[model samples]
Target: MSERREGALDEATIEARLKAELPAWRYEDGWIRRTYKTAGWKSTLMVINTVGHLAEAAWHHPDLTASYAWVEVRLMNHAAKGITDKDFALAAKIEEVVGWQPGAEGGPLEGTPTDPRFAYVKYDR
Candidate 1:
């Protein structure tokens, strides 16, 4: 079998990277995690699906926990036995996709719904 080679980052480096790049994610128990507060169940599902797609594309899956109004994404390199660049890369992508807020001065007006019904609200911003 071909061996998969991956190098895990030390705790100090991981902490610095998390602070600078992924401010919302927390380092705990050998994993970096971030919880996204959604508008409701529908929004929750959207977040889950988005995460799934991103994870699949990156081939670096994260541990996801969902509730009626929130989803928590935790990333770690199990094969490497610690946090690695892969985890951070996926985490950044997840933050970008999930935290995207459309609608600018000249940007497309078709952004996330402001209406309570369809909007994927974020409690922590």
Candidate 2:
């Protein structure tokens, strides 16, 4: 996770991992995206702030938006033509940090994978 070490996965491997690790995140226009819903705008701000920290720490930033009750993340590796290991790993951690639980309008970890709170993310566009 430091200095972008050689990427543990190659292109093909990263793609497959993305599907499993980022089940809530979909690829659109070559960017990985996921949505998060919160109880209100305050919670939305909390998620946005937290994600900002995560992104800064990981050095793999995302385009984030926080509205009245939702937060969305859009990730892309400009250096890479498509999804890569960095995106999958970052997505995995974001899901965990968000703590999305079931029946809770947030992303949750199920047979596929998610977090607590049961809500998933989406693109506004």
Candidate 3:
């Protein structure tokens, strides 16, 4: 196997960066995590699948736990054994996809799609 990469940020650096860049995420137990609440089971599944797609595309997977109404995502660079730029990039993409609102400027669902099947609500806490 190839040698593990370096450049994992220290805890203090991770904490400071997370605070500024991802306020919704917390550094805990050697991982950066964020929990998103959804409107219901369907929304929860949607969130999970969306995260999975983003993770796969970025090639930086996160640890995920989900219930009927919430999903928690935890990110760390296992090869580096700490937080890295990969984690933050994936997290930002996840946040953007999850928090998108219909009719928002330049949104895919611009003009507000009328289909109830397309509606997915993010629970704000």
1 or 3, greater by TM-score: 1
Clashing residue pairs for model 3: none
Residue-wise lDDT of candidate 2 within 1-125, one digit each (tens)?
11333343344455556676666667666677888877666668878988989989999999887788888899877666456678777888888877644434454533313444533433221
Segments of candidate 3 deviating more than 4 angstroms? 1-5, 106-119, 123-125
Q: Tell me the deviation in Å of residue 23 in model 3.
A: 0.6
* Cα lDDT for residue 16, candidate 2: 59
Candidate 3 TM-score over all chains jointly: 0.82
Better of 1 and 2 by lDDT: 1
Instruction: Give the CA lDDT, 0 to 100, for residue 91 in model 2.
Output: 82
Supply candidate 3's per-residue lDDT for 51: 93
What's the best-to-worst order under lDDT?
1, 3, 2
Q: Give lDDT tens digits, candidate 3, residues 4-117.
A: 348688887888888999889999998999999876798889899999999999988999999987999999999898888999899989987887665766756574354666
lDDT of 1 by residue, 1-125 (tens): 12333688878888899999999998998899999999889999999999999999999999999999999999999999888899999999999888877653358666776788777958455
What is candidate 1's TM-score against the reference? 0.89
Q: Against the true structure, whose lDDT is highest?
A: 1
Q: Per TM-score, what order, best first?
A: 1, 3, 2
